[model samples]
Target: MDRRTLLTLGLGGGVAVLALGAGVAVRQVMESRRAARVTGTKLGAPFRLTDHNGQPITEAAFQGRPSLLFFGFTHCPEICPTTVYDMETWLSEMDVAPEALGAYFVTIDPERDTSEFLKSYLEPQSHRILGITGEPEAVWDMAKSWRVYFQKRPLDGGDYTMDHYASIFVLNARGEVVDLIPYGTAADEAKAKIAAVL
Candidate 1:
């Protein structure tokens, strides 16, 4: 190739690389902003739900104490049960007073997970963790306010299952989200995050 043509091609390639690099940087900044927005979101939206004990509860209940909030249903074949077990283990290991850390399991499948059913489902897992359920609209509204994503999936025999966000939310006394411990996080790491909020 001619010298001028080679020079032109080299310059074009360099410009392309720089443009690509700039695009990547812009994308990274946008992602960072999105992450900030998610973390800055206020939690504890208004809702009236029944606890496992059939007692009325609201967003007010989350105030005045640090909490570990998890969203799942009793019928989950794996993640839900495993997370419950992990939560129970973490709380036991932390040795925190029961009243000190309010651990809750909010059901996204309220259609089938009633207050009574939740009581039975959670009893074996850990009394330390309470279950929350209510009318479908109210339950889903609460979840939506917290940015939880849950959708129903049809199964065989006309049954249905839930696809949901499976993470433990650690919140401070005022119910502001401190950190999210994703499913299958290391026990020590999860405990550290929970303890930080507490």
Candidate 2:
């Protein structure tokens, strides 16, 4: 190859790398800012809901232990499962005792995500995570209290999908939300934050 052509190709490759790096940096910053917005804000309140088993469950049930709470519907194609798995893996790596750590999956779409649906949907999680759902008003009230953003968008075939906050609420043992852990957090960082609560 000619010297000029070789140099140009090298520069193009460098530009691509720089562009990718910049995109990553920007995303990290955005996620950090989003996390900051929700942190230091008192979250979670006394709210009544039901678990995937059709039994009553309350927010106070998470008290006496630090908990990781995520608000998403089971129908989510990617983000919901990915976030749950990531959080679960982080918890496992931290070696958090099941008693010391309460992990919950709260569904924002209660209409379609019935108790049976949630039970089957999370069966693969080995039942490690508890799924919460209830009447629309009850669920939405809990989401609003937690300041979680979620909305349902109708699909083509009379079905719908849920868009929700991708961050997990980190609650202290007293059940007070102490931090917002953003999606894709470095596992080491996640472990450190979770360990502090444990």
Candidate 3:
């Protein structure tokens, strides 16, 4: 190629690299701002639901303590289990027992996650966490109020699965969402967010 043409090509490549870098930086900043927006936005609302124990409860039950809430179904194969494990691990390292934080394992699939099923599904949690499930309408009300995403999809042989937001929702002592702990966040990051209000 001619000398001028070669130089032009090199400069174009450099410009492309710089533009890509700028785009990445912009995305990072936007993501941070979005996280902060969700943090400051009020979330959670009143709902009377049945716990794994089959007792009726309302949002009032979770009042007066910081809560680490997760919405997933018992039948979830991967994301649900992984997120729960991460949150449990993060809280295990906390000086406070996980239960003290009012941990909740709310099932978004009420049709399948009956109170009896929820009891067995959470047995591994050793009663440290409460599982919430009730009528579909009540569950939808709770999920909708929090802006949590959840939808059921049918699979082969008439089976189905739940698609939901898997992040761990952090509520301050008064039940206002203060931050969202993304799934797989570093333990220190989760701890810092929880500790800030504890």
Local accuracy of candidate 3 as per-residue lDDT tens digits, 27-126: 4544665676743335567889999999998998667888888888888776666666776676777766754688888888999999999898786854
lDDT of each: 0.77, 0.71, 0.71
Count: clashes, candidate 1? 0
Compare candidates 1 and 2 on lDDT and give the better one.
1
TM-score, prediction 1: 0.80
Task: Report the Cα lDDT for candidate 1.
Answer: 0.77
Best candidate (score: lDDT): 1
Best-fitting candidate, measured by TM-score?
A: 1
Q: Which segments of model 3 are wrong by more than 4 Å?
A: 1-40
In candidate 3, what residue range of length 10 has the lowest lDDT sum?
A: 9-18
lDDT of 2 at 185: 78
